[model samples]
Target: MSKILIIEDDLSIGEMMTMYLYEEGYEVKRAENGTQGEQIFQTFIPDVVVLDIMLPDIDGMKLCSIFRTGSTVPILMVSAKSEVTDRVRGLQTGADDYLCKPFSMREFAARIQALLRRSQSFPTPVHETPAGHPIRLDFEKRCLYVNNKVVETTFSEFEIMRLFWQNEGRVYSREELLNKVRGFDTYVTERAIDVHIANLRKKIEADPKDPKHIKTVWGVGYKFLPDPSLS
Candidate 1:
């Protein structure tokens, strides 16, 4: 009985999704524009958001970016724009999942369920790097802390860090990181992954030039090594 917010300008689509989600046993809220959507998001506090990209008041990308600044709620972006750039932009801006228009209802429902599952699974799991001075990831709050100071993170950045923190010593190629984080359906490039990793290093590492937590694996890929002593 999770709550859901549908922020879509199209009345027909919004009503239809509301009805469908109601039938699926979810408490649903609806808003037709970004301003109203933002208000409802703060008040209703939904578990997941079904956001349309082309809103009248504010665009979905802007709204998503705003939401990411405060909350870690899963944002599933929906749009008619099927271009790879559009998809990548949506993901880069902090949408947890992006779905092109004309998507099947079954897949839509499944994606919502998956996002909710991921969001609600961790109650109080705190992952820490194995060093004298460690980086801590608070799963419940979707927060990253270095030296006990909060470090702001985008949704995609948080996911990548979570993957690495969860599997401390495992190597992940650029392709694998893209597929695992942004999903296989999205057209995310290796460069995007590199950019995300670079940004993360800047936030957590004292020196981005020589990263300690996330290390390069020669030509293969990158791995997260917990113990700073191993660096």
Candidate 2:
């Protein structure tokens, strides 16, 4: 059974979700605050985490960043704040998916299911760039290496990098990139894609101000250039 950890201070909501998830045949654990959430996270080692944004202790964004530092576990961030900036910030902070409050139980369950599917579907083994290339991708490890040094990347960043690296020079609109990385069902603004792309450039480009690997297509979207010098 897939293990699911829910860190939510709202008792009623947390219990409701736990009951539904249990019926769905998942092993579920709930934490009421970020401190407890952190403790449970280490012991439980959940496959997917459903985290609430507002906690009495540490906030969800900080917890998400903490979880992301050491694990690739998919995070589904829930927040009552539905502003575009809030959603974009959550994605930028390393959440794989986000849902606003007062959401339906069915959609919540579906979102969890999608996360589980995506997490399980990653290809195994390492993938390397062509010889003389500066980038290397380890799919099995879900890590990126530049110039033989490991570069810290969030889950979303790694996925975007993997897509761009595999399909060099192909322009992907923000909408297309969002769908490809976060799944079509995930309701996020296309601007979030721009945020992710910008973050990736910071990690991979020699100079983020003048990016060489990931380039903006202007009037469209962005594309990757394996060998920017040749382009």
> TM-score for each prediction?
0.83, 0.94
- Residue-level lDDT tens digits of model 2 in 41-96: 99999999999999999989999999988887889999999999899999889888
> Candidate 2 at 144: error in angstroms?
0.7
lDDT computed for candidate 2:
0.88
lDDT of 1 at 115: 74
Worst 10 residues of 1 by lDDT: 182-191
Best by lDDT: 2
CA lDDT of every candidate: 0.83, 0.88
Question: Which candidate leads the pack in TM-score?
Answer: 2
TM-score of 2: 0.94
The regions of model 1 sitting more than 4 angstroms off are 128-131, 154-156, 174-199, 207-210, 218-220
The C-alpha RMSD in Å for every predicted model, in order, reads 2.9, 1.5
Give the Å shift of residue 205 in candidate 1. 3.3
